[model samples]
Target: MRINLRGLNRTKKTLADGTVKIFWYAWKGGPPLSGQPGEPEFIASYNAAVARKVITPAGVLLSILQGFQASSDWDDLADRTRRDYVKLIKVIEKDFGDMPLSALADQRARGEFMEWRDKRAKSSRRQADYGWQVLARILSWAQGRGLIARNPCEKGGRLYRGTRADNVWTDDDEASFLARAPAHLHLPLLIGLWTGQRQGDILALTWMQYDGAHIRLRQSKTGRRVVIKVGAPLKAALDPVRQKEGQILLNSDGAAWTPDGFRSSWRKACAASGVVGVTFNDLRGTAVTRLALSGCEVPEIATITGHSMRDVNAILDAHYLHRDQRLGDSAITKLENRTKSPN
Candidate 1:
């Protein structure tokens, strides 16, 4: 495609703050071979040939989308994250209109372009964060393609500092919620509570991982096999949920529920049981806490919870530390009694 430069001039428009506005005009459909500008003919702008012809911003984005879809880098990314990129491109197109990455970079000069992103209305903070991540990725990719010299997002002010929701569940809360959960969800609930396995892993559990006396399953997040002896309470919970089929946890339709579905059901169960602020992930924290309270060593709890020693201790500090106060108090009382009796 060739650009038409007739009647268009490349000029530096001074801003109110005396900063130069850098701009050059070229044909939208193609590069300009020859055309006389109406003004500022003395200024010479460099004409460069691109490896791939960029006709429009939307065209470049479509190329990037196709490129990512066919590339190995797109593999192994979480399905949701991958979808976010596609969704984000559509969002940018809708909000800012399709423009070349180079042109977009130029427009990003004063950071007002990003202000539009912040002004967008979102249903949740998570959606807002996803938008930020999408823009960040696009800018990073643009930089790597040499389409832009630097990512304006690399300046870091445009990104949102999202708050992390809580992931702490108590034993009583877990018990209450599980009691109210549907009969079919027993195994899924046990896996969530006992192993702290992610919803995906729990839904993926097979009978081979469950031995008569212990459970051995590889964690998806870390790719580490964790083995834990079946405690009586957990065994009881699992007994009713065990199946001879492919997956230990299957929805009513005999298919595994997605994480989103599991989270929705979990929230409902929590509400029914009158347990507030307990997410499915809190079960993992509860498992770690229960192990620490039972006097399991730090390393042992880490094996069961798939936690680093530091994280295990942090959980212990938060949930199990105060529970040990009674033990300390009992020891002090015994010491006082012995001194009084000897006197």
Candidate 2:
């Protein structure tokens, strides 16, 4: 699976002018330039392109990836979504790059793919489900392009089921995490809990997105615009940080946090916190719990959380709203009081 194409890397060639051009052959006579060889960052970009390419096959999965890469539809996808697709595509390419598309015509191919997915990235069924979803998209796009007759991935089933299966952080879990979490991580923790936003959105937060009153942005995954009121907790957390310009959040270096950098920091915090099975994502659902406990209706929670009313109700019913015994007691009390006084 770990095929090396280092020899296929671009070689530097002297141009008609004194400058040099870096390029790889497309399997032909000359090292043809693929882009602006004059650009300063050409080598870095050229190497990236090389890493994304695959060799000749009986119509390899790489060819479909290549086609998708060149399609306008790829450009239309949100950047975060595109990154996710590319990441999963590379995983599939690593395994099945040499396999022919004709092999996929067999219906059993879909089941085999699911088998492979189930075994991958152990401990996270959600990630495996996501990979299958992306694979289906690529297959669908290929079908649209007439590259294949039917999408083999259409028969594949998801690996993860119930959305509420993830751990929702409790008050005790929050206290445990904050007690051990280093000071630098406090802002992100507060933001995650208070705004009920995803990790991607938390990392991407800018000062411009926050007025003194609320935080507003279009969510990357759902494309929903959410304007969350700056409650007391979030306000107190933000007030003390005097660097109140540009990006609202920053890494230890005071630069904006990259996704990997933030994850690494969060992992360290979680490990030190001693809260097993709890995740940063769980904090968002925890916020939903907090809202429900405060008597916010499902519609009110959806407006703030950017989830559907159905999803909000599901969360409240399954995870957040522990049905109070007092409510049942009150109902029984009302029934008894309304009885005909034994007359």
Candidate 3:
């Protein structure tokens, strides 16, 4: 039986016996729904003329969200970068009212978002710049996928600049820091003062790194194995401090200190030692400076410090070539010895 509701008020089904089966409408004190008040009950219907599947507005919106799910490609980014990307969503929502991604991607809308970000209280300008850098990468990914025509942060420049720059530790400051470092930290401190390894690299030293008399390891950052002969001063500090702890250095709690924790404790030690304007990184610089001053060649210093020629040159210029009275006297002694007769 074929039923057509496009005709008179009541829809009819034509039966096999040539009889009409009328399906009457239930009115709510008026007329049939999608119809007018009772007349012939004929309602003009346009869809019956064609036969095509309908896509609702809700379905289109759902497909857009599905595309967003398809665009979830956060792999290969660094851990910190991935965290920053997650935070970008919150920044977007706070700056602009939550809307479909398409609607929010307008140039003016993005400009407004950046303006709102400038007014954010949680982050300073530099920090905000870092966040937006991550956002720019995400927008690039979106652009490649045809989600957006271009990156919104393409025009954003560096947010903050011109703060206090590099603060290298000085010679007198190094001597004072070493003299005041606690007995337990003495060897570790000397290693830091002699070898320009980062705190984490210094802390990573184990008994295995000591090959009978020398300390050596393939540095994590540079991937270069540097063998440093334990000199008298370093050995003297190491002798009494060496223990069955298996590792070279451990905190008061008998556990190894993380780089950040070591840096925090070292800062306190520096303050107590009365050394001002120095950073933990400056310790590495101090070690490199002292080595160059002690007549170690650039290659020799780089062997231990994991710095390249260019880096060593900077350290030498900033620290080594600046000669004092001690160096001048030594130079004069060498000259006199070379010209003088042995009587």
Candidate 4:
């Protein structure tokens, strides 16, 4: 029997003997304890319900998740986007892969899952919120196919609204960092500060990307094609230490650097320089600021950074670009000189 409970549409069963059994939202078993199917009671009720032929033998949650990944919608996503989504979805599977998909419609079950996920992440708002969103998308897909009664995450609130704003490295910061950095870090630092490309893009670069005058590659994050002119500082840094290995950034064994390896090295270097609250990614913003300070227009900055015009302007206005004492002095001198030599 289907009944409305606590303003929610719930499912239950009326036995042949006129006894009412509160079935779980999935209709596969008796109502779950606090909507937790991991408990033995939920499993026993499900088995009994199936044996009596009172509920259909629908497959577990894993089957639905696999089918969703095989759908045309999944294929339409960008490669990077699909990879990121699957990373989060895989974590969800580790916890609830064997459970019935119908349990997802129950408010208590959904709440428990979110609570467990956030707690495991140590209350990291970004990881918890993004992972929850991935879960919400999967459940929404199931609901659309009539598998679940409804999406439980529709009421989930925001946990993190963090921005990318960070401190850009000044010339003094760069000099201090380089003086203390190991030999392996110098090339990456020069690339970051001069080209303003992302860390991932810089690490992925190969000898084929360099054509004597310019570097050519497609950005992995945004998939935008970028061709940056090789500036003097970058060229100078590479001419002395350019590796023969395939990727531009390689470990001592001439192997391509993994993401974790690069991060560890970067952290150690940061500690060596005693810089705080700044990361290698901040170099991209510093490059934008350098361009803006040199009187480069918004579009020109976008060409170098692979960011759109809107993003370049926002970075200049919100984060990186700033007027130093030199700019202030320039403004004052130009006005004063103009007044004294008024033509």
Note the Cα lDDT for every prediction shown. Answer: 0.58, 0.72, 0.59, 0.71
CA lDDT, candidate 2, residue 3: 33
Q: In model 4, which range of ten residues has the least summed lDDT?
A: 25-34
Misplaced by over 4 Å in model 2 are 1-59, 76-84, 118-128, 160-166, 242-244, 318-343
RMSD of each: 15.6, 8.8, 22.2, 14.5
Question: Candidate 1 — worst ten consecutive residues by lDDT sum?
Answer: 42-51
Selected candidate, larger TM-score, 2 vs 3: 2
- Best candidate (score: TM-score): 2
lDDT of 4 by residue, 207-283 (tens): 76786678887775666788899899889877676655467777767688887798998898889898777889889
- lDDT for model 3, please: 0.59
Residue-by-residue lDDT tens digits, candidate 1, 6-119: 443343433222234433334222222222433333123214212223433444444443344334344334344555566675676566544444554564542655565556
The segments of candidate 4 whose C-alpha lies over 4 angstroms from its true place after superposition are 1-64, 68-87, 94-122, 136-157, 161-166, 241-245, 322-343
Q: Of the candidates numbered 1 and 3, which has the greater lDDT value?
A: 3
How does model 2 score by TM-score? 0.74
- Number of residue pairs clashing in candidate 1, backbone atoms closer than 3 angstroms, sequence gap of 3 or more or interchain: 7
Q: Give the per-residue lDDT digits (tens) of candidate 3, residues 234-300.
A: 7777766666436788876878776667777877888889988767766787777677768989988
How far off is residue 135 in model 3, in Å? Answer: 6.7
Please provide TM-scores, in order, for all candidate models, with all chains considered together. Answer: 0.62, 0.74, 0.53, 0.66
**Model 1 lDDT, residue 114, Cα:** 54
lDDT of 2 by residue, 224-277 (tens): 888899999889888777455677888778888877788888898889888778
